[model samples]
Target chain A: MLSKISFLSLMGPLRSVDIYQSLWLIIEGMVGILIVMLLIYLVVIWVNKIMNKIEMSIDKNR
Target chain B: MGSFSFITQALGEITLPMVIMWVIGILLIWLALAKDFEPALLLPMGFGAILVNIPHTGVLGDNGILQWLYHAGIEASEALPLLLFVGIGAMIDFGPLLSNPKMLFFGGAAQFGIFVTVLISVLLGFELKDALSIGVIGAADGPTAILVSQKLASNYKGAITVAAYSYMALVPIIQPFAIKLVTTEQERKIRMKYNPQGVSKTIKIIFPIAVTLIAGMIAPDSVGLVGMLMFGNLIRECGKLDSLSETAQGPLANIITIFLGITISFQMQARQFLSWGTVIAIFLGLFAFIFDTIGGVVVAKLMNIFLPEDKKINPMIGGAGISAFPMSARVIQKMALKEDCQNHIIMHAVGANVAGQIGSVVAGGIILSIAHGFGL
Candidate 1:
């Protein structure tokens, strides 16, 4: 009886992953990855431009 | 017969496995205290291991202080781990990562460990949600692991926390083997030179906000951790808030670590922690970390293929992509310097390290959302 109850509880949560759900998850993961990549690129570019401006300012002072 | 009975009475309570556990506990303590292998965490963990196995110690009993700390600090509201992040944020310098932003990619790639471990856990008979939560332990960041575990599988919180911390301290030992196995001697000795010019104060201050804004929108669940992390970095880079940053980096961080480490230890009592599941989980967590390193290094090597001539990256910094932060970065730099004393990969590695922190948090948030979506 104890084993039966435990088995029921475990099996109760089993959900079949259909095509739509799998697609949705894949799209979600891709979107997350894309956003991370874009943000990283923007930060690198912004930092580079700012550093260049600073270098120019320093050169003018010299 | 009476004298023999007394000896038998005393010896009857001691079990062989229990004795072995105690010896392991003592060895862990020795490693932490004598050998200084992450004494900050291992010492408390070791002492907790000893206390929990004291046969009749009430410290882990229903009304004991250790149990109370577990309830108050960990389970009740997840206070200690989140608060520890505030300290970690304060101590971190974002300048290196901010200057060479490309290192962020390495960080994201390193999180391959968390997912790989999740798949492995599933194979080990854990459900999808529980497996993902358990796998997050490999990200090498405790708070992120705790946050994900609480959200997904609070039942196994104690085991998960212990595994996360133990594996993180083992990085120095674990990573060298992984690094040596993957890379040829010639690759380990490969040198690349690029120095990021000094970053302006304005850009440095703005970088964290931009990251928070970008990452927050993408992975909303991670906002609290990622936001505060960037906020701490913002204060550090802002230059005017020097004193505030110093306080966050020092006393505030140390005090919080004290609370976090001890509170985490409270959950390590033998009754809850000595199961076969716990042992398997530790090794599996290490597997996640190893795969994360492999994923990062491989991607880095792949990236080198597309780089414009003269800009090829040395792949060693890929190991820094794990969320161990300065520790991972320092290890990568040490390895690099061994090959060439003048080589400096710290900046690039720091960038990857910080990126890994953000990536791990985002991954945690995603896992939380997925679990929530499934109503798990």
Candidate 2:
């Protein structure tokens, strides 16, 4: 797709025609980070909820 | 083997490039001692450069201590860097990040530079593997750079390590400039209040493990990298292994660091590191950092557009999303304070900084995942 941009000439052996794969890597890599980080966030929230509840029960017993 | 002939052979082996490498080595040493630029790593790497470049040095040939260290520590299985990750994980306090869990998004956003640099490197004619290695210099974490490049077998490993560590040292200098490029004075002055949240001990204990499982499941290639890091953190938070955690955080980490720098320099033989590719790798490394800052800042700004005014994040916090850790977080705080003395954003920035730590490793894993996807 990049090859059609007449103004975007590449200097390497991997021409614009070869860049579609690279573009995909870039796209998925960023999205993947966002997804993974978000998942981690959810885990923290989930873990906190459970732990906080247990701690509250222990305090009531005390 | 005669004494007279040995002198002649040794003299003949001396070349201008070797001298040039010595100068470069000296420059690194000077930076370490005089400028305090990553003294722990640069000092030894600089000394190693001088040692390896000596003609017919036993360090490069059979029975070479340096060569043995390189093969055993790095090339054999990435043991040293991974071990170092445990120490790094132990040294981290995830309290800030766990409290401000939302900062994790900034971590993902800050890795924008790595991907951008990969495309740019490919555009400039680097083979995809070399381009990926070069781009990872933006990870802003040294061990991640080394492990990624080594695993990928990038020909530019030495240059990538040098670039990664050097740029990390220059974070204070590089980040402010990059943050300035995308933000105005008004935006820089954007104030965010700091509210300390009580992070439960159990949550702290579970965080690293949860991060590993979550990150590992998505990118199995990241298990080693992510798992080791989280393992180190577990020791720190487990509450029962204080001494073990201290050892991991102190002595073990120190000894490994001492080995890591000089061992990595094995690849910095004058013949390997003096190429045009090294120079290009260095420049591309800078761009990765710049682009990372842009990515994080832009995302934060975009988020501001959708949020209420009182809830707007000081976009500078996004720049701290690189894995440069406390340094990046500290820089953001310094910048915030400069804008307004009462503006204390250290907690928020620390949250993002630590998240960057995870973000960078995950980004490295993503690169590995992409590499695997291509069947490389």
Return the top candidate by lDDT: 2
Question: For residues B1-376, what per-residue lDDT tens digits would candidate 1 score against the true structure?
Answer: 2455754653577665557557767776787788776677667766776666665567767887777877887678767777667667767766677667788788877877776676666556566666777878877888888767876754456677667777787777777777887787667766766667566677767777887787777777777777777777777777788898888778877776666666666655655666767677777888988988887888788887898646777787888888886788888888888887877877788888887887777777766666677687
In CAPRI terms, model 2 is classed as: medium
Candidate 1 TM-score restricted to chain A: 0.69
RMSD of each: 5.5, 2.0
lDDT of 1 at B305: 81
* CAPRI-style class, candidate 1: incorrect
Candidate 2 residue-wise lDDT at B165: 90
Model 2 Cα lDDT, one tens digit per residue, B1-376? 4568876887798998899989989999999999898999999899999999999998887699999999999999999999999999999998988888889999889999999999899888888889999999999999999999999999899999999999999999999999999999999999987766579888888888889988988888888899999999999999999999999999999999999999988988988999888899899999999999999999999999999999999999999999997899999999989988988899999999999999999999989998988776
